[model samples]
Target: MERGNRIIYNQDGKIILQTGETTGDVSGHDTITELHYLDVEYGSIDYNKQHIESINPITKELVLKDIPVILTDEQKRLKALEEELSMLKEENKNRDSEIVNTAFEVVNMKLNNNI
Candidate 1:
């Protein structure tokens, strides 16, 4: 069995979504029955949702009459930024813990006259 992808587009020539399906032999009639949209700029398909309006049998491409409202690039960037910020916050927490441990070690050394 081999996997296949169907690129779906809108009437305005903009991509809306895409779907993935696998093809099988006679005994294995497994196949993809969903639509996927192509991200022309990113050169990849968005598989987050199926937004197929129709299928163009002649061209073997899926079509959509209206594009779905998804997160814009700005929103995606913001999400990424938020994730990074969360990671940094966790890192800072670890750093703060390390600082506190170092301070404790210093205090113990001074009490033992090692400082």
Candidate 2:
């Protein structure tokens, strides 16, 4: 993944943090599953150990603003392709080894018949 991202904090940087092209791409505030979507996609996602909050002006209370955190369509598509290629490579290796083992078995059987 690229080093730089385009997300900005919402709610005076309070309610959510968003990036990419789509809405709520890197959501902050609450987390789900032992991980969140933001964790899966971004290199760094900062949150307080005790409490997580959004960014905003220091002096005043902030209201909710809608910002998007997104992974571009192209990026998502490329990631799928990479996964497919990796699986294909693993399958190819298995097939290649099968061929080699079969060939070795055939050679050994032929030698036994000759003996």
TM-score top scorer: 2
lDDT for 59 (candidate 1): 75
lDDT of each: 0.70, 0.57
User: Per-prediction TM-score, please?
Assistant: 0.28, 0.29
Residue 100 shift from truth in candidate 1, angstroms: 1.4
> Clashing residue pairs, candidate 1?
17-36, 17-37, 18-35, 18-36, 18-37, 19-35, 19-36, 21-32
lDDT string for model 2 (17-83, tens) is: 4543434444433333342222222423332222224334454333334444577999899999999
Residue-level lDDT tens digits of model 1 in 1-115: 6656666687798966666666766233336586454433352335454355766766767674545668999999999999999999998998999999999999999999966
In TM-score terms, candidate 2 sits at: 0.29
| Candidate that scores best on lDDT | 1
Question: What is the Å distance of residue 109 in model 1 from its true position?
Answer: 3.5
Candidate 1 regions exceeding 4 Å error are 1-70, 91-93, 111-115
At residue 14, candidate 2 shows an lDDT of 69
